[model samples]
Target: MRWTKYWWLVMAVMLISTFAVFAVHDEAKGPEKFGRYEFKEQDKKAATDECDAGGKPGPEFVPTVRDKEPNLALLKDAKPEASSQLEGWCPRRHCVEYLNDGFYNNCRSWIIGAIPGWAQIDIGDVANVNRIYFGSDHSQGFLDRTTADFDILVATSKADPNSDANTWTKVYTHKGDPISETTEFTFKDVEARWLRLHIRTNGGARVDEIEIYGGKDPMDVEPSGKATTTWGEIKTE
Candidate 1:
C-alpha cells in the first residue's frame, strides 16, 4: 500500500508540472499571437489609402463677384418703405422718409434709412467673417453726430419703402453720445438675413452708404430700384 501511494503522488506532481509549463508557454506567446491577429498589412494599407484619399490638403477657397450678385427670382419685387422719419427731407435721396423736425430739432437726422443698404459677405462657405464695408458719399456726410445712436436689425418681414414704423429684429446697437466721421465702428459675430439701420441722435448726420464685406452677406434676392421721385412726394410733415 505505501508503494502504491508513493507512485500516485509522483504521477500527480508530474501532471501539475506539465500543466504549469504549458501555461507559461501560452502566456509568453499570447502577445505575439494577438499582435499578428490585431495588426494586418492589408489593414494598414487600407488605412493609408483612406487617409490619402480623404485627408488630402485642398486649395484655398475664394468668393467671386458672381456669388455677390442678388438672385432676383428668389426676392420679392416689393420695395421697403420707411417706418419713421425723425427729421430731414421726406424721401430724401435713397431714404424713404426724411424728418425735418421733431426729436433732434430740425438738425437733419434721417432715421432708419433703407434696411440693409449693403450686406455682409463670407469668403468661404463655412468661414466666419470679421469685416464689412458700406458705400458712402462724402457730400451725404459721414456718421457725424454729437449724440449718435444706431442699431442694426435683422428683419423677417419686408421693410416698407414708404413708412418708418415697421417691426424688426434688432441685431446690434451702438450706444454712445455720438461718433465722429473719422471714427469707424466695428461689430463681430452678428448673424442676420436682413439688417436694418436705426439712428437716434441729438445732432445732424447722414450715412451715404454701407457695406458688409467679411461676414456672410444676407442672401439678397434682388437689388433696390432707382428712385424716380424727389423726397417731398414720398413723405409728409
Candidate 2:
C-alpha cells in the first residue's frame, strides 16, 4: 500500500509538471456578422455585473470532499486547439470559472468554435479518466442546439484533432439536446496522456464550462461505502 500510494503521488507530480510552461493573456476584437453566428459588443462591465447578479455554483455535480482534485485534465496547461476563441470570451486559461463553477452571470460566457472547435490538455502521460462534464451559458441563449454533436478523442501525442495526420481514438461521443444547466457524461474509462474535445455547432458552439473527472485504481480511492483501513497503516490526506 505504501509503495502504491507513493507511485500515484509520483505520477500526479509528473503530470502536473507539464503545465508549468504555459502562460496566457486574454484580448479580442469588434463584433460583426460572421457566418451563421453573431457576436455581441464587448461589454465587460455588463458581463461582470451579470456574474455578480445571478452566477450560481457551476457544474455542482460530484461533491468536493469525495471528488477532490476531481478534474485531472490540467487547466493550468490548457490552450485553444483551433484558431483560438473570441479573444476575451474564449477558452484557454480564461475559462476557469466554467471549470470550477457553471455560473450563469448573463454576460460572461465561454464560446468555442463555429462547427469544429476544440480544447485539449496534455496530461504528460497515460492517465485514467471515466467521466466528463460540459456546460454552456444560457444567459445569452439556450445551449441545447449549440452544445451537441461532438467527439471526445484521445491521442498519445499532442496532434491536430481535426486532421488525419495524427493518431487519435474516439473514446466517447455525445449527441443530444443540452437543454439543462449542466450535464455529466460517463464512460467505461480511457487511459491516455491527452484529451481533445471536438465540438460541432451549426455555426458556433458556446459552452460555459467543462470538467474531466476520474481516477486510476480502486486501491487509491475511498468510494462511498467501504471497509475500514487495516491496522498499522498511516493514512495521508
Candidate 3:
C-alpha cells in the first residue's frame, strides 16, 4: 500500500533533478560571451578600440630668431674705433669706441660735422650676417644734430674700412633721417668676418648702439619653455 503512494514522488524528483543539470550546462559560457548574448564583430571591435593606444598630436615648428639672439659680439674682442677723422667741431675721436663699448646711454655717442666716419669690428672668424641695428644718438643733452646716413658692409676677411671699400659687400644704405629710437636694417645673409658701419653726418652724426644679427658664431641657447599636456589633450581618434 505505501509503495503506491511513494512511486509518483520518486519519479517527479528524478525529472526535476535532470532538468536542473541541463539548465546549468547551457548557462556555462566562454570569456567572449556577453550578458545573454554571444559577442559579435562590432562588439569585438569596440572592445579592441577601448584597449588601443590614444592618439597623438603632429609636430609643430618653433622659430629661434624671435627676439635678439644673444649678442655674439660679447664673445670676442674687437676694438671699435673710428677709421679716420678730420678736424671738426664735433668730437669724432673714440666715437665708435664708446658706441661699441656695449653700453647704451645718453652720455656717450659719436658725432661728426659733415665728414663721413666709418667704424669696423673684426669678428675674428667668418660668420653669417643677415641684419644690423643701430641706436639713434638724438638723445637729450647733446647738441642739436640730425640723423646720420649710414651703410652696412660685410667681408670675409679683415679689410681696411677706408681703403678696401670695394672689397667689402655693401648690404644696407640709409638716407639721412632724424632717428631717436632703435633703427633696424635687414639684409640677405652673407658670410663675413668683418662688419663695418659707415656714417655720413648730416647736421651731426651720432651712434648710441650697434647690433648685428644672424651670425654663424655659436650662440648660447636656452631650454625651450613649452606647455605641458594633460589627460584632456589625449584623444582616441
Candidate 4:
C-alpha cells in the first residue's frame, strides 16, 4: 500500500510540472490577439487610434526617389513572382505582375490570410544588391490594409528557385506599425540572384511596388527626379 501511495504521489508531481511547463510556453508566445490583429500591444494601440480618428493613422510617407542607380528588378531578364494571387474585388489590380512596374497608385499586389505571403524577384544573375525601396497604396484609407511586418531574403540557386524549401538567407526583417508609401531598407551587400519579400503579417495590404537596386549607395546619389511614375498618371492609367 505504501509503494502504491508513492507511485500516485510521483504521478501527481509529474502532472503539476507538465502544467507548469505549458503555462510558461504560453506566456513566451505572448498575447495572441492585439485588438483585431495578431501581434504586439503597440500595434493594437495604433490600430485603435486609426479607427477612433476619422482620418489616417500615421504620418504620410513621401519617398525620396533615387535616380543615380538603376533598378535591377527592371532588368529585361529579371522576373517577379508571388506565392498566390489575392482573389476577389480588384482581381486584375492585385497581382504579381504589377510589383516592379514603377506604378504606386493604380494597382497593388496583395496577400491576405493566416498563412504568410511572399513576393520574389529573380534579378537574372548574381549581383551585389543592398538597397530595397518598397511602396504601398495609401489611397485605400486604412492603416490595417498595409504591410505590418515582413522579411527580406536572398538566395543563389539554379534549381527550384520558387520553392519555399529552397535555402534562403534572411538579410533584414521589417516591423511596420504600418509600412509607408515608400520604405527604404538597406543591408550589407549580398551577391544573390534571387531576392524575396516575405510578408509575415498584413491586415489587407496593397503592396504597390518593390524596387531592388545594385552597385552604388543611394545616399551618395543626388535626387535628380522621382524614380516612379507620377501619381497623376498612375491614377488615370
Candidate 5:
C-alpha cells in the first residue's frame, strides 16, 4: 500500500512540472494580436504601439545583413517574382517587388496569398552562393503570416518562367516555429542564377527580405542581366 502511494505521488509531480514548463513558454511568446494588427516581439517587448499606428521604422530597424559582404540578392539588376500576393487590401505595400529591397519596414514586406506560394529572385547572372537570410517585419509587427515551414531552392536554369517544376534543387528546409526575425541558412557553395523561397505552410505569409550572400570575386558574380541569362521573370500584375 505504501509503494502504491509513492507511485501516485511521483506521477502527480511529473504532470505538474510539465504544465509549468508550457506555461512559462506561452508567457515568453506573448500575445498574437493587438487591435487587428499582428504582434511581433523585437528586443523582447510586450508590444510596440508605434507599429499599431503605422509609424516609421526606428533606429533599431537596421538591415539584417550585419557584415561587409554585399547582399547578392539586392543587386540593382535583380528581379523578383512571386506565385501570388495579397492584393487590393493594402495597395502597393504588399507587393513582391519589396522582397529584396534591403528594407525592413512593415509596409515594405510581401504578403503572399497562397499557402504554398514561392518568392523568387533572379540575380541576373550565374553566381556561386552559399548563404541566405530571411526575415519578417521587425519595424512594425509580424503576423502569423510570417512563414512557418519553407524551403530554400536554387536553379541553374528554368524551363518555364511561370513554373518551378523539376528545375530547382533544395538547399535548406525549415519546419518549426514561424520565422519572425532574421534567420540564416548556409550550405555548400552552389552556382545558380535563380534563388527561391518556397513556402509550404503558413497563414497568409509575409516575406520582408531575402538576402543571398556569396563571398569574394570568383564565388560571387555581379549580374548584368545580359542576353546570356537563362531565366526570364514572369511579370507580376
Candidate 6:
C-alpha cells in the first residue's frame, strides 16, 4: 500500500509539473488577436474623443500642409520600390534629404522632413498585417520629434503612379518620445494594400528605416507566456 501511494504521488507531481510548464508557455505566447497596426494609448484616447465628438478618424485631423518644409528631400526623388529579398517579404526605404552626422559609426542616420510628408509603400495584394518596426538614424535630430506627431496609414487599393496624391486609411499615431527607434504597433482585422508613414511634424530629426512584417498564415504554435513590458511591443498573440 505504501509503495502504491508513493507511485501515485510521483505521477501526480509529474503531471502537475507538465501542466505548469504548458500554462507558462501559453501565457508568454500572448493573445491570438494580435493586431497588424495599433495606436499609442494617448493617440487612441484622442482619436476616441474625436470620434465621440463627431469627428472622423485619421487624415481628417492631419494637417493638409506645413508652414515650413524640412531642409532634407528625397534621395532619388522617386517613390519606394518593392523588394522580395526576405522571402514573402517586401521592404523599402525612403530617405530624407539629411543624413546622420556619422553617429553609431554611420549606423545612425536620418532624413528630416516636415509634417504631412510621408513614405508610402505597397504591401502587395490586400493582406492582413500584424507587425511593424520603426527606427531613426539619429534620435536627436529634428525629424525624430516628428514620429510622435505622425500617423501611419494603410490603403486597400494599388497606388497610382501618375497621381501626386494617394489615398490611404489612417491606422495609428505615435505618442512617445521622438528618439525611440524600435517601435511596434498592433492592428486587428485590418486589410490594406499600402502602408504610409505620415508625419505631423519633423520633430527636428530624420527616420532611418521603417519595417512592416507579419502577414503570414496564422500558426498553431504554443504560447510563450511572457508579457511585454513596453508599449512598443504590442502583440495580438
lDDT (Cα, 0-100) at 79 in candidate 2: 31
**Candidate 2 displacement at residue 221 in angstroms:** 14
**Per-residue lDDT over 180-215 for candidate 4, one digit per residue giving the tens place of the 0 to 100 score:** 455667776566677887787646555666677765
lDDT of 2 by residue, 88-188 (tens): 54232234334333233223345554456676655445556656655554332343335656766766555665633446667666676542344566665
With a 3 Å backbone cut-off (N, CA, C), the pairs that clash in candidate 5 are none
TM-score between candidate 1 and the true structure:
0.33
Task: Score every model by TM-score.
Answer: 0.33, 0.52, 0.53, 0.57, 0.64, 0.42
lDDT of each: 0.30, 0.45, 0.46, 0.53, 0.60, 0.37
Q: lDDT score of model 6?
A: 0.37
Q: Write the per-residue lDDT of candidate 3 for residues 47-67, one digit (tens) a residue.
A: 223321122111111112225
Q: Encode model 6's per-residue lDDT on 45-150: one tens digit a residue.
A: 3322322211111101111111221101111121343211112111112223112111110122234443345655554445454445554422221222335565
4-78: candidate 5 lDDT, tens digit per residue: 999999999998975653222111222333222221223322123322224344213323233545566666577
Q: Which has the greatest lDDT?
A: 5
Residue 151 in model 5: lDDT: 73
- Counting clashing residue pairs in each candidate, in order, gives 28, 3, 1, 0, 0, 30
Q: Candidate 2: worst 10 consecutive residues by lDDT?
A: 228-237
Candidate 5's error at 141, in angstroms?
Answer: 2.4
Mind sharing the TM-score for model 4? 0.57
Ranking by lDDT: 5, 4, 3, 2, 6, 1
Error of 3 at 63 (Å): 19
Q: Could you tell me the TM-score of candidate 6? A: 0.42
Error of 5 at 97 (Å): 0.4
